[model samples]
Target: MSEPDPGLSSGAVVAEPETLHAPPPRLSSPLARLALDFCASRPAVAGLAVILVVAVAAIFAPLIVPQNPYDLAQLDIMDGTLPPGSPSYAFGTYWLGTDVQGRDMLSAIVYGLRISLLVGSVSVAFALVIGSAVGLVAAFFGGGLDSLLMRIVDIQLSFPAILVALILLAIFGNGVDKVIIALVIVQWAYYARAVRGSALVERRKEYIDAAVCLGLGTRRVLFGHLLPNCLPPLIVIATVQVAHAVALEATLSFLGVGVPITEPSLGLLIANGFEYMMSGRYWISFFPGVALVVVIVAINLVGDRLRDLLNPRLQR
Candidate 1:
Protein backbone atom coordinates (compact mmCIF):
# COMPACT_ATOMS: atom_id res chain seq x y z
CA MET A 1 0.00 0.00 0.00
CA SER A 2 2.86 2.39 0.78
CA GLU A 3 4.57 1.62 -2.59
CA PRO A 4 1.35 2.23 -4.44
CA ASP A 5 0.85 5.59 -2.71
CA PRO A 6 4.30 6.90 -3.83
CA GLY A 7 2.95 8.25 -7.11
CA LEU A 8 -0.66 8.90 -6.03
CA SER A 9 -2.40 8.83 -2.62
CA SER A 10 -4.18 5.53 -1.95
CA GLY A 11 -6.32 6.81 0.91
CA ALA A 12 -4.76 10.12 2.02
CA VAL A 13 -1.50 12.03 1.39
CA VAL A 14 1.32 11.11 3.81
CA ALA A 15 2.76 14.50 4.82
CA GLU A 16 5.90 15.13 6.90
CA PRO A 17 5.31 14.94 10.67
CA GLU A 18 4.38 18.41 11.97
CA THR A 19 6.63 19.94 14.61
CA LEU A 20 5.22 19.27 18.11
CA HIS A 21 4.65 22.41 20.15
CA ALA A 22 4.85 22.10 23.92
CA PRO A 23 1.60 23.09 25.61
CA PRO A 24 1.66 26.18 27.82
CA PRO A 25 2.27 25.53 31.51
CA ARG A 26 -0.92 25.17 33.47
CA LEU A 27 -1.50 27.48 36.48
CA SER A 28 -1.60 25.59 39.77
CA SER A 29 -4.85 27.29 40.65
CA PRO A 30 -6.81 30.18 39.16
CA LEU A 31 -7.06 31.86 42.56
CA ALA A 32 -3.33 31.48 43.26
CA ARG A 33 -2.51 33.00 39.89
CA LEU A 34 -4.96 35.83 40.45
CA ALA A 35 -3.38 36.57 43.84
CA LEU A 36 0.10 36.64 42.31
CA ASP A 37 -1.12 38.98 39.59
CA PHE A 38 -2.60 41.36 42.17
CA CYS A 39 0.55 41.37 44.30
CA ALA A 40 2.62 42.21 41.25
CA SER A 41 0.44 45.18 40.28
CA ARG A 42 1.57 48.59 41.67
CA PRO A 43 -1.79 49.92 42.83
CA ALA A 44 -2.75 46.60 44.38
CA VAL A 45 0.56 46.33 46.19
CA ALA A 46 0.40 49.91 47.47
CA GLY A 47 -3.17 49.51 48.59
CA LEU A 48 -2.33 46.30 50.40
CA ALA A 49 0.62 47.96 52.09
CA VAL A 50 -1.49 50.85 53.34
CA ILE A 51 -4.16 48.51 54.66
CA LEU A 52 -1.56 46.38 56.38
CA VAL A 53 -0.08 49.37 58.18
CA VAL A 54 -3.51 50.53 59.30
CA ALA A 55 -4.39 47.04 60.51
CA VAL A 56 -1.15 46.83 62.46
CA ALA A 57 -1.83 50.16 64.05
CA ALA A 58 -5.35 49.13 64.98
CA ILE A 59 -4.28 45.79 66.46
CA PHE A 60 -1.45 47.18 68.59
CA ALA A 61 -3.05 50.44 69.63
CA PRO A 62 -2.92 49.54 73.33
CA LEU A 63 0.81 48.91 73.22
CA ILE A 64 1.84 51.45 70.61
CA VAL A 65 -0.18 54.42 71.80
CA PRO A 66 1.79 56.86 74.01
CA GLN A 67 -1.18 57.34 76.30
CA ASN A 68 -4.49 55.70 77.08
CA PRO A 69 -7.10 58.12 75.86
CA TYR A 70 -9.82 56.16 77.63
CA ASP A 71 -8.18 56.34 81.07
CA LEU A 72 -9.37 59.57 82.69
CA ALA A 73 -6.68 59.15 85.36
CA GLN A 74 -3.91 59.62 82.77
CA LEU A 75 -5.41 62.89 81.58
CA ASP A 76 -4.49 66.41 82.81
CA ILE A 77 -6.83 69.37 82.74
CA MET A 78 -3.84 71.68 82.01
CA ASP A 79 -2.91 69.52 78.98
CA GLY A 80 -6.16 70.58 77.39
CA THR A 81 -5.81 73.23 74.65
CA LEU A 82 -2.04 72.74 74.42
CA PRO A 83 -0.78 73.91 70.99
CA PRO A 84 0.73 71.47 68.50
CA GLY A 85 4.39 72.42 69.15
CA SER A 86 4.43 72.69 72.91
CA PRO A 87 7.95 71.72 74.15
CA SER A 88 6.57 69.33 76.79
CA TYR A 89 4.25 67.66 74.28
CA ALA A 90 7.03 66.59 71.82
CA PHE A 91 6.52 65.79 68.12
CA GLY A 92 4.95 62.31 67.95
CA THR A 93 3.84 62.58 71.60
CA TYR A 94 1.37 65.33 70.99
CA TRP A 95 1.68 64.73 67.27
CA LEU A 96 -1.97 65.67 67.09
CA GLY A 97 -2.07 67.58 70.42
CA THR A 98 -4.74 67.24 73.13
CA ASP A 99 -8.52 67.39 73.15
CA VAL A 100 -10.61 69.68 75.37
CA GLN A 101 -10.74 66.92 77.96
CA GLY A 102 -6.90 66.87 77.92
CA ARG A 103 -6.79 63.47 76.23
CA ASP A 104 -3.74 62.88 74.05
CA MET A 105 -4.88 63.42 70.45
CA LEU A 106 -2.70 60.58 69.17
CA SER A 107 -4.05 58.19 71.78
CA ALA A 108 -7.56 59.33 71.08
CA ILE A 109 -7.04 58.57 67.39
CA VAL A 110 -5.70 55.11 68.16
CA TYR A 111 -8.58 54.31 70.51
CA GLY A 112 -11.04 55.91 68.12
CA LEU A 113 -9.72 53.67 65.34
CA ARG A 114 -10.44 50.64 67.52
CA ILE A 115 -14.05 51.70 67.95
CA SER A 116 -14.51 52.67 64.31
CA LEU A 117 -13.00 49.47 62.97
CA LEU A 118 -15.03 47.40 65.41
CA VAL A 119 -18.26 49.06 64.42
CA GLY A 120 -17.42 48.85 60.72
CA SER A 121 -16.36 45.21 60.79
CA VAL A 122 -19.23 44.00 62.96
CA SER A 123 -21.78 45.91 60.90
CA VAL A 124 -20.38 44.51 57.65
CA ALA A 125 -20.46 40.97 59.04
CA PHE A 126 -24.06 41.34 60.15
CA ALA A 127 -25.03 42.83 56.80
CA LEU A 128 -23.28 40.04 54.92
CA VAL A 129 -25.08 37.29 56.83
CA ILE A 130 -28.50 38.85 56.48
CA GLY A 131 -28.00 39.91 52.87
CA SER A 132 -26.56 36.60 51.69
CA ALA A 133 -29.44 34.70 53.30
CA VAL A 134 -32.09 36.96 51.83
CA GLY A 135 -30.47 37.00 48.40
CA LEU A 136 -30.01 33.24 48.24
CA VAL A 137 -33.60 32.56 49.30
CA ALA A 138 -35.01 35.15 46.92
CA ALA A 139 -33.00 34.07 43.91
CA PHE A 140 -33.27 30.32 44.51
CA PHE A 141 -37.02 30.40 45.09
CA GLY A 142 -37.84 33.20 42.62
CA GLY A 143 -41.49 34.13 41.74
CA GLY A 144 -43.31 35.85 44.63
CA LEU A 145 -40.45 35.48 47.07
CA ASP A 146 -38.03 37.20 44.74
CA SER A 147 -40.57 39.91 43.93
CA LEU A 148 -41.39 40.49 47.56
CA LEU A 149 -37.78 40.65 48.73
CA MET A 150 -36.66 42.87 45.89
CA ARG A 151 -39.66 45.15 46.41
CA ILE A 152 -38.69 45.65 50.01
CA VAL A 153 -35.10 46.30 48.96
CA ASP A 154 -36.32 48.89 46.46
CA ILE A 155 -38.55 50.60 48.99
CA GLN A 156 -35.69 50.77 51.50
CA LEU A 157 -33.37 52.08 48.79
CA SER A 158 -35.83 54.88 48.02
CA PHE A 159 -34.94 56.49 51.34
CA PRO A 160 -31.45 57.80 52.06
CA ALA A 161 -29.47 55.27 54.09
CA ILE A 162 -28.48 57.94 56.63
CA LEU A 163 -32.12 58.83 57.11
CA VAL A 164 -33.04 55.22 57.75
CA ALA A 165 -30.12 54.94 60.16
CA LEU A 166 -31.22 58.12 61.90
CA ILE A 167 -34.77 56.87 62.33
CA LEU A 168 -33.54 53.59 63.73
CA LEU A 169 -31.18 55.39 66.12
CA ALA A 170 -34.00 57.61 67.32
CA ILE A 171 -36.15 54.61 68.07
CA PHE A 172 -33.39 52.51 69.62
CA GLY A 173 -31.66 55.27 71.60
CA ASN A 174 -27.93 56.10 71.43
CA GLY A 175 -25.48 53.26 72.12
CA VAL A 176 -22.88 51.10 70.37
CA ASP A 177 -25.33 48.25 69.86
CA LYS A 178 -27.92 50.63 68.43
CA VAL A 179 -25.32 52.10 66.04
CA ILE A 180 -24.43 48.61 64.81
CA ILE A 181 -28.09 47.73 64.37
CA ALA A 182 -28.68 50.91 62.39
CA LEU A 183 -25.69 50.21 60.16
CA VAL A 184 -26.67 46.60 59.56
CA ILE A 185 -30.24 47.56 58.71
CA VAL A 186 -29.18 50.23 56.25
CA GLN A 187 -26.30 48.33 54.60
CA TRP A 188 -27.71 44.81 54.20
CA ALA A 189 -29.75 45.74 51.13
CA TYR A 190 -26.59 46.44 49.11
CA TYR A 191 -25.26 42.95 49.74
CA ALA A 192 -28.68 41.43 49.07
CA ARG A 193 -28.87 43.09 45.66
CA ALA A 194 -25.36 42.01 44.72
CA VAL A 195 -25.84 38.45 45.89
CA ARG A 196 -29.21 38.13 44.17
CA GLY A 197 -27.74 39.14 40.82
CA SER A 198 -24.84 36.74 41.20
CA ALA A 199 -27.07 33.92 42.44
CA LEU A 200 -29.35 34.31 39.43
CA VAL A 201 -26.42 33.64 37.11
CA GLU A 202 -24.86 30.90 39.24
CA ARG A 203 -28.12 29.02 39.70
CA ARG A 204 -28.21 28.34 35.93
CA LYS A 205 -24.59 27.17 35.62
CA GLU A 206 -23.77 23.56 34.61
CA TYR A 207 -22.53 22.64 38.10
CA ILE A 208 -25.78 23.85 39.65
CA ASP A 209 -27.71 21.82 37.08
CA ALA A 210 -25.58 18.77 37.85
CA ALA A 211 -26.13 19.25 41.57
CA VAL A 212 -29.87 19.49 40.97
CA CYS A 213 -29.79 16.36 38.83
CA LEU A 214 -28.04 14.53 41.66
CA GLY A 215 -30.95 15.41 43.98
CA LEU A 216 -29.02 17.85 46.15
CA GLY A 217 -31.26 19.81 48.49
CA THR A 218 -32.05 23.41 47.52
CA ARG A 219 -30.43 24.71 50.72
CA ARG A 220 -27.23 22.78 50.00
CA VAL A 221 -27.18 23.96 46.39
CA LEU A 222 -27.73 27.54 47.41
CA PHE A 223 -25.38 27.68 50.39
CA GLY A 224 -22.67 25.17 49.46
CA HIS A 225 -22.42 25.64 45.70
CA LEU A 226 -23.76 29.07 44.83
CA LEU A 227 -22.47 30.93 47.88
CA PRO A 228 -18.78 30.21 47.27
CA ASN A 229 -18.98 31.40 43.68
CA CYS A 230 -20.72 34.61 44.72
CA LEU A 231 -17.99 35.61 47.21
CA PRO A 232 -15.57 37.70 45.11
CA PRO A 233 -18.00 40.54 44.54
CA LEU A 234 -19.33 40.22 48.04
CA ILE A 235 -15.81 40.61 49.46
CA VAL A 236 -15.15 43.79 47.50
CA ILE A 237 -18.56 45.18 48.41
CA ALA A 238 -17.99 44.36 52.05
CA THR A 239 -14.65 46.18 52.08
CA VAL A 240 -16.14 49.35 50.65
CA GLN A 241 -19.21 49.03 52.81
CA VAL A 242 -17.10 48.94 55.96
CA ALA A 243 -15.76 52.38 55.12
CA HIS A 244 -19.29 53.59 54.54
CA ALA A 245 -20.48 52.10 57.80
CA VAL A 246 -17.63 53.75 59.70
CA ALA A 247 -18.50 57.07 58.15
CA LEU A 248 -22.17 56.58 58.90
CA GLU A 249 -21.43 55.78 62.53
CA ALA A 250 -19.31 58.90 62.73
CA THR A 251 -22.14 60.93 61.20
CA LEU A 252 -24.67 59.56 63.65
CA SER A 253 -22.37 60.29 66.55
CA PHE A 254 -21.84 63.82 65.31
CA LEU A 255 -25.60 64.26 65.15
CA GLY A 256 -25.85 63.21 68.83
CA VAL A 257 -27.83 60.08 67.97
CA GLY A 258 -24.99 57.60 68.09
CA VAL A 259 -22.59 56.20 70.72
CA PRO A 260 -22.96 57.30 74.36
CA ILE A 261 -21.47 60.69 75.28
CA THR A 262 -18.96 59.01 77.61
CA GLU A 263 -17.52 57.09 74.63
CA PRO A 264 -17.01 59.72 71.96
CA SER A 265 -16.58 58.54 68.36
CA LEU A 266 -14.60 60.45 65.76
CA GLY A 267 -17.78 62.27 64.79
CA LEU A 268 -18.48 63.23 68.36
CA LEU A 269 -14.92 64.47 68.70
CA ILE A 270 -15.34 66.58 65.60
CA ALA A 271 -18.63 67.97 66.83
CA ASN A 272 -17.18 68.76 70.23
CA GLY A 273 -14.07 70.31 68.79
CA PHE A 274 -16.12 72.56 66.53
CA GLU A 275 -16.72 74.77 69.58
CA TYR A 276 -13.02 74.81 70.47
CA MET A 277 -11.77 75.46 66.94
CA MET A 278 -12.17 79.24 67.41
CA SER A 279 -10.64 78.95 70.89
CA GLY A 280 -7.34 77.71 69.30
CA ARG A 281 -7.81 74.03 70.27
CA TYR A 282 -7.74 72.80 66.65
CA TRP A 283 -6.12 69.44 67.34
CA ILE A 284 -9.15 67.68 68.89
CA SER A 285 -11.19 67.50 65.71
CA PHE A 286 -8.30 67.72 63.27
CA PHE A 287 -6.58 64.60 64.54
CA PRO A 288 -9.73 62.50 64.54
CA GLY A 289 -10.62 63.81 61.07
CA VAL A 290 -7.19 62.81 59.85
CA ALA A 291 -7.56 59.40 61.43
CA LEU A 292 -10.94 58.89 59.79
CA VAL A 293 -9.53 59.96 56.42
CA VAL A 294 -6.62 57.57 56.71
CA VAL A 295 -8.76 54.58 57.62
CA ILE A 296 -11.42 55.18 54.97
CA VAL A 297 -8.88 55.99 52.28
CA ALA A 298 -6.86 52.89 53.07
CA ILE A 299 -9.97 50.67 53.00
CA ASN A 300 -11.16 52.17 49.73
CA LEU A 301 -7.79 51.62 48.12
CA VAL A 302 -7.75 48.00 49.19
CA GLY A 303 -11.33 47.49 48.02
CA ASP A 304 -10.53 48.95 44.60
CA ARG A 305 -7.53 46.64 44.34
CA LEU A 306 -9.64 43.64 45.32
CA ARG A 307 -12.23 44.50 42.70
CA ASP A 308 -9.52 44.61 40.05
CA LEU A 309 -7.98 41.37 41.22
CA LEU A 310 -11.29 39.46 41.38
CA ASN A 311 -12.66 40.70 38.05
CA PRO A 312 -11.08 38.79 35.12
CA ARG A 313 -11.73 41.59 32.69
CA LEU A 314 -9.89 44.04 34.95
CA GLN A 315 -6.83 41.79 35.34
CA ARG A 316 -3.82 43.05 33.41
Candidate 2:
Protein backbone atom coordinates (compact mmCIF):
# COMPACT_ATOMS: atom_id res chain seq x y z
CA MET A 1 0.00 0.00 0.00
CA SER A 2 2.76 2.41 -1.08
CA GLU A 3 4.71 1.97 2.18
CA PRO A 4 1.54 2.51 4.22
CA ASP A 5 1.08 6.06 2.80
CA PRO A 6 3.23 7.77 5.44
CA GLY A 7 1.64 11.21 4.99
CA LEU A 8 -1.84 9.81 5.67
CA SER A 9 -0.77 7.60 8.61
CA SER A 10 -1.84 8.64 12.17
CA GLY A 11 1.70 7.85 13.37
CA ALA A 12 3.14 10.25 10.74
CA VAL A 13 0.88 13.05 11.94
CA VAL A 14 1.70 12.39 15.60
CA ALA A 15 5.44 12.29 14.86
CA GLU A 16 5.50 15.81 13.35
CA PRO A 17 7.27 17.47 16.27
CA GLU A 18 7.62 20.66 14.19
CA THR A 19 3.85 21.15 14.46
CA LEU A 20 4.09 21.03 18.22
CA HIS A 21 7.09 23.35 18.15
CA ALA A 22 5.19 25.89 16.09
CA PRO A 23 3.75 28.70 18.21
CA PRO A 24 0.19 28.34 19.43
CA PRO A 25 -2.35 30.40 17.51
CA ARG A 26 -1.85 34.02 18.35
CA LEU A 27 -4.36 35.19 20.93
CA SER A 28 -5.68 38.74 21.13
CA SER A 29 -4.20 41.10 23.69
CA PRO A 30 -5.35 40.39 27.25
CA LEU A 31 -6.78 43.88 27.83
CA ALA A 32 -8.80 43.93 24.63
CA ARG A 33 -10.07 40.42 25.19
CA LEU A 34 -10.91 41.18 28.80
CA ALA A 35 -12.92 44.24 27.80
CA LEU A 36 -14.80 42.28 25.13
CA ASP A 37 -15.49 39.46 27.55
CA PHE A 38 -16.79 41.86 30.20
CA CYS A 39 -19.08 43.59 27.73
CA ALA A 40 -20.42 40.24 26.57
CA SER A 41 -21.19 39.06 30.10
CA ARG A 42 -24.85 39.11 31.21
CA PRO A 43 -24.62 41.53 34.12
CA ALA A 44 -22.55 44.11 32.26
CA VAL A 45 -24.85 43.84 29.26
CA ALA A 46 -27.97 44.29 31.41
CA GLY A 47 -26.40 47.24 33.25
CA LEU A 48 -25.71 48.94 29.93
CA ALA A 49 -29.31 48.32 28.85
CA VAL A 50 -30.68 49.91 32.01
CA ILE A 51 -28.37 52.89 31.62
CA LEU A 52 -29.45 53.34 28.00
CA VAL A 53 -33.12 53.33 28.92
CA VAL A 54 -32.62 55.93 31.62
CA ALA A 55 -30.49 58.04 29.28
CA VAL A 56 -33.04 57.88 26.48
CA ALA A 57 -35.87 58.84 28.81
CA ALA A 58 -33.84 61.76 30.11
CA ILE A 59 -32.87 62.85 26.61
CA PHE A 60 -36.40 62.75 25.19
CA ALA A 61 -38.16 64.00 28.28
CA PRO A 62 -40.15 66.67 26.47
CA LEU A 63 -41.59 64.27 23.93
CA ILE A 64 -42.03 61.29 26.27
CA VAL A 65 -43.66 63.11 29.17
CA PRO A 66 -47.41 63.67 28.97
CA GLN A 67 -47.19 67.07 30.64
CA ASN A 68 -44.31 69.53 30.54
CA PRO A 69 -43.23 70.09 34.13
CA TYR A 70 -41.65 73.45 33.35
CA ASP A 71 -44.61 74.83 31.48
CA LEU A 72 -46.79 76.96 33.76
CA ALA A 73 -49.64 76.82 31.26
CA GLN A 74 -49.92 73.00 31.40
CA LEU A 75 -49.59 72.64 35.17
CA ASP A 76 -52.78 72.94 37.24
CA ILE A 77 -52.51 73.64 40.97
CA MET A 78 -55.56 71.40 41.39
CA ASP A 79 -53.52 68.48 40.05
CA GLY A 80 -50.84 68.95 42.72
CA THR A 81 -50.37 66.17 45.32
CA LEU A 82 -52.85 63.83 43.61
CA PRO A 83 -52.05 60.27 44.81
CA PRO A 84 -51.41 57.42 42.42
CA GLY A 85 -54.48 55.76 40.79
CA SER A 86 -56.69 58.87 41.10
CA PRO A 87 -59.35 59.55 38.48
CA SER A 88 -58.83 62.60 36.18
CA TYR A 89 -55.17 62.06 37.25
CA ALA A 90 -55.17 58.66 35.62
CA PHE A 91 -52.19 56.28 35.66
CA GLY A 92 -51.14 57.56 32.27
CA THR A 93 -51.84 61.21 33.11
CA TYR A 94 -49.83 61.54 36.33
CA TRP A 95 -47.92 58.31 36.31
CA LEU A 96 -45.37 59.22 39.02
CA GLY A 97 -47.77 61.68 40.63
CA THR A 98 -47.36 65.47 40.87
CA ASP A 99 -45.15 67.47 43.24
CA VAL A 100 -46.36 70.23 45.55
CA GLN A 101 -45.56 72.73 42.79
CA GLY A 102 -47.97 70.86 40.48
CA ARG A 103 -45.05 69.70 38.29
CA ASP A 104 -45.43 66.17 36.92
CA MET A 105 -43.20 63.96 39.05
CA LEU A 106 -42.33 61.81 36.06
CA SER A 107 -41.40 64.84 34.00
CA ALA A 108 -39.53 66.36 36.89
CA ILE A 109 -37.55 63.15 37.36
CA VAL A 110 -36.75 63.05 33.64
CA TYR A 111 -35.58 66.66 33.63
CA GLY A 112 -33.75 66.14 36.88
CA LEU A 113 -31.94 63.20 35.33
CA ARG A 114 -30.80 65.51 32.57
CA ILE A 115 -29.33 67.93 35.11
CA SER A 116 -27.81 65.20 37.25
CA LEU A 117 -26.33 63.40 34.25
CA LEU A 118 -24.97 66.61 32.81
CA VAL A 119 -23.34 67.68 36.04
CA GLY A 120 -22.01 64.22 36.79
CA SER A 121 -20.65 63.71 33.28
CA VAL A 122 -19.09 67.14 33.09
CA SER A 123 -17.54 66.86 36.52
CA VAL A 124 -16.11 63.47 35.70
CA ALA A 125 -14.73 64.82 32.45
CA PHE A 126 -13.17 67.72 34.26
CA ALA A 127 -11.63 65.41 36.83
CA LEU A 128 -10.28 63.04 34.18
CA VAL A 129 -8.70 65.77 32.10
CA ILE A 130 -7.15 67.66 34.97
CA GLY A 131 -6.06 64.58 36.87
CA SER A 132 -4.64 62.75 33.88
CA ALA A 133 -2.65 65.75 32.80
CA VAL A 134 -1.22 66.28 36.24
CA GLY A 135 -0.46 62.61 36.73
CA LEU A 136 1.11 62.21 33.30
CA VAL A 137 3.34 65.20 33.78
CA ALA A 138 4.34 64.17 37.25
CA ALA A 139 5.07 60.61 36.30
CA PHE A 140 6.96 61.52 33.13
CA PHE A 141 9.05 64.08 34.97
CA GLY A 142 9.58 62.95 38.54
CA GLY A 143 11.19 64.85 41.49
CA GLY A 144 9.76 68.23 42.34
CA LEU A 145 6.81 68.03 39.98
CA ASP A 146 5.75 64.64 41.34
CA SER A 147 6.22 65.78 44.91
CA LEU A 148 4.17 68.93 44.37
CA LEU A 149 1.34 67.11 42.59
CA MET A 150 1.29 64.32 45.15
CA ARG A 151 1.36 66.81 47.99
CA ILE A 152 -1.71 68.51 46.60
CA VAL A 153 -3.45 65.18 46.24
CA ASP A 154 -2.54 64.23 49.80
CA ILE A 155 -3.78 67.54 51.18
CA GLN A 156 -7.02 67.26 49.30
CA LEU A 157 -7.51 63.69 50.44
CA SER A 158 -6.99 64.72 54.06
CA PHE A 159 -10.35 66.48 54.04
CA PRO A 160 -13.69 64.80 53.49
CA ALA A 161 -14.98 65.37 49.96
CA ILE A 162 -18.28 66.77 51.16
CA LEU A 163 -16.52 69.23 53.44
CA VAL A 164 -14.34 70.40 50.57
CA ALA A 165 -17.36 70.65 48.32
CA LEU A 166 -19.19 72.60 51.00
CA ILE A 167 -16.34 75.08 51.39
CA LEU A 168 -16.08 75.63 47.64
CA LEU A 169 -19.82 75.88 47.18
CA ALA A 170 -19.95 78.36 50.06
CA ILE A 171 -17.33 80.50 48.37
CA PHE A 172 -18.75 80.24 44.84
CA GLY A 173 -22.43 80.54 45.86
CA ASN A 174 -25.10 78.14 44.65
CA GLY A 175 -25.51 77.62 40.88
CA VAL A 176 -25.11 74.79 38.40
CA ASP A 177 -21.65 75.98 37.39
CA LYS A 178 -20.59 76.45 40.99
CA VAL A 179 -21.82 73.01 41.91
CA ILE A 180 -19.80 71.50 39.06
CA ILE A 181 -16.74 73.47 40.17
CA ALA A 182 -17.08 72.13 43.69
CA LEU A 183 -17.44 68.57 42.41
CA VAL A 184 -14.45 68.87 40.12
CA ILE A 185 -12.30 70.23 42.90
CA VAL A 186 -13.32 67.48 45.24
CA GLN A 187 -13.07 64.63 42.70
CA TRP A 188 -9.88 65.21 40.67
CA ALA A 189 -7.53 63.99 43.36
CA TYR A 190 -8.93 60.48 43.13
CA TYR A 191 -8.34 60.41 39.38
CA ALA A 192 -4.88 61.89 39.81
CA ARG A 193 -3.85 59.15 42.22
CA ALA A 194 -5.22 56.43 39.97
CA VAL A 195 -3.58 57.80 36.86
CA ARG A 196 -0.31 58.48 38.62
CA GLY A 197 -0.04 54.91 39.82
CA SER A 198 -0.85 53.60 36.34
CA ALA A 199 1.51 56.01 34.63
CA LEU A 200 4.37 55.07 36.90
CA VAL A 201 4.08 51.45 35.81
CA GLU A 202 3.52 52.23 32.14
CA ARG A 203 6.47 54.59 32.05
CA ARG A 204 8.79 51.68 32.88
CA LYS A 205 7.47 49.35 30.18
CA GLU A 206 9.74 48.34 27.28
CA TYR A 207 7.45 49.94 24.72
CA ILE A 208 8.00 53.29 26.40
CA ASP A 209 11.75 52.78 25.96
CA ALA A 210 11.19 51.79 22.34
CA ALA A 211 9.11 54.92 21.74
CA VAL A 212 11.81 57.04 23.30
CA CYS A 213 14.48 55.30 21.17
CA LEU A 214 12.40 56.04 18.05
CA GLY A 215 12.63 59.73 19.01
CA LEU A 216 8.87 60.09 19.34
CA GLY A 217 8.00 63.23 21.25
CA THR A 218 7.39 62.90 24.99
CA ARG A 219 3.82 64.18 24.64
CA ARG A 220 3.12 61.62 21.90
CA VAL A 221 4.40 58.73 24.00
CA LEU A 222 2.72 59.89 27.17
CA PHE A 223 -0.65 60.57 25.58
CA GLY A 224 -0.75 58.07 22.73
CA HIS A 225 0.73 54.98 24.32
CA LEU A 226 0.71 55.52 28.08
CA LEU A 227 -2.65 57.23 28.30
CA PRO A 228 -4.55 54.65 26.26
CA ASN A 229 -3.10 51.85 28.37
CA CYS A 230 -4.08 53.70 31.52
CA LEU A 231 -7.72 54.10 30.43
CA PRO A 232 -9.13 50.78 31.72
CA PRO A 233 -8.52 51.64 35.34
CA LEU A 234 -9.53 55.22 34.73
CA ILE A 235 -12.82 54.09 33.17
CA VAL A 236 -13.59 51.93 36.23
CA ILE A 237 -12.71 54.86 38.47
CA ALA A 238 -14.85 57.24 36.41
CA THR A 239 -17.95 55.07 36.62
CA VAL A 240 -17.79 54.91 40.41
CA GLN A 241 -16.95 58.62 40.56
CA VAL A 242 -19.98 59.46 38.47
CA ALA A 243 -22.26 57.78 41.02
CA HIS A 244 -20.48 59.70 43.76
CA ALA A 245 -20.84 62.92 41.79
CA VAL A 246 -24.55 62.34 41.34
CA ALA A 247 -24.97 61.64 45.03
CA LEU A 248 -22.90 64.71 45.87
CA GLU A 249 -25.06 66.87 43.63
CA ALA A 250 -28.14 65.48 45.31
CA THR A 251 -26.64 66.15 48.74
CA LEU A 252 -25.86 69.72 47.77
CA SER A 253 -29.32 70.18 46.37
CA PHE A 254 -30.81 68.73 49.50
CA LEU A 255 -28.74 71.23 51.46
CA GLY A 256 -29.95 74.00 49.11
CA VAL A 257 -26.59 74.60 47.38
CA GLY A 258 -27.07 72.63 44.17
CA VAL A 259 -29.18 73.79 41.21
CA PRO A 260 -31.26 76.77 42.27
CA ILE A 261 -34.85 76.59 43.55
CA THR A 262 -36.08 77.69 40.10
CA GLU A 263 -34.90 74.34 38.74
CA PRO A 264 -35.96 71.33 40.84
CA SER A 265 -33.51 68.43 40.91
CA LEU A 266 -34.37 65.07 42.50
CA GLY A 267 -32.84 66.21 45.79
CA LEU A 268 -34.89 69.37 45.70
CA LEU A 269 -37.96 67.28 45.04
CA ILE A 270 -37.11 65.11 48.05
CA ALA A 271 -36.40 68.17 50.18
CA ASN A 272 -39.71 69.74 49.22
CA GLY A 273 -41.57 66.50 49.85
CA PHE A 274 -40.10 66.10 53.33
CA GLU A 275 -42.66 68.55 54.76
CA TYR A 276 -45.58 66.64 53.24
CA MET A 277 -44.37 63.31 54.65
CA MET A 278 -46.44 63.79 57.84
CA SER A 279 -49.49 64.86 55.81
CA GLY A 280 -49.87 61.26 54.50
CA ARG A 281 -48.62 62.15 50.99
CA TYR A 282 -46.10 59.32 51.04
CA TRP A 283 -45.83 59.27 47.24
CA ILE A 284 -44.15 62.69 47.20
CA SER A 285 -40.77 61.64 48.58
CA PHE A 286 -41.14 57.88 48.28
CA PHE A 287 -41.09 57.77 44.50
CA PRO A 288 -38.11 60.09 44.09
CA GLY A 289 -36.28 58.34 46.93
CA VAL A 290 -36.83 55.00 45.23
CA ALA A 291 -35.63 56.38 41.89
CA LEU A 292 -32.43 57.73 43.46
CA VAL A 293 -31.75 54.48 45.27
CA VAL A 294 -32.30 52.43 42.14
CA VAL A 295 -29.97 54.60 40.04
CA ILE A 296 -27.15 54.64 42.62
CA VAL A 297 -27.42 50.91 43.21
CA ALA A 298 -27.44 50.12 39.52
CA ILE A 299 -24.43 52.31 38.88
CA ASN A 300 -22.56 50.82 41.86
CA LEU A 301 -23.29 47.28 40.68
CA VAL A 302 -21.95 48.06 37.22
CA GLY A 303 -18.91 49.82 38.61
CA ASP A 304 -18.06 47.00 41.00
CA ARG A 305 -18.32 44.47 38.20
CA LEU A 306 -16.11 46.56 35.95
CA ARG A 307 -13.51 46.89 38.69
CA ASP A 308 -13.40 43.15 39.20
CA LEU A 309 -13.30 42.46 35.46
CA LEU A 310 -10.40 44.81 34.89
CA ASN A 311 -8.27 43.49 37.74
CA PRO A 312 -7.31 39.87 37.15
CA ARG A 313 -6.22 39.52 40.77
CA LEU A 314 -9.77 40.24 41.85
CA GLN A 315 -11.24 37.53 39.66
CA ARG A 316 -12.71 34.58 41.56
Writing each residue's lDDT as its tens digit, candidate 1 over 38-98 gives 7776766776787677678878988898787777778778877776655443234566677
Weakest 10 consecutive residues of candidate 1 by summed lDDT: 84-93
Q: Could you give candidate 2's per-residue lDDT for residues 1-316 as a string of tens digits?
A: 3476657766555556787789877557987767677777677677767778888988898888777677788778888898765544432567777778777787788888888888888999999999998888889889998999999999999999999998898889989999999999999999899999999998999999999999999889989998998987998999999889989998999998788987758888889899999999878888878877777777777888888887757876
Error of 2 at 142 (Å): 0.6
- Give each prediction's root-mean-square deviation over alpha carbons: 7.5, 4.8
lDDT of each: 0.84, 0.85
- Please list the residue runs of candidate 2 whose C-alpha ends up more than 4 Å from where it truly belongs after superposition: 1-36, 39-41, 89-92
Off by over 4 Å in 1: 1-27, 87-92
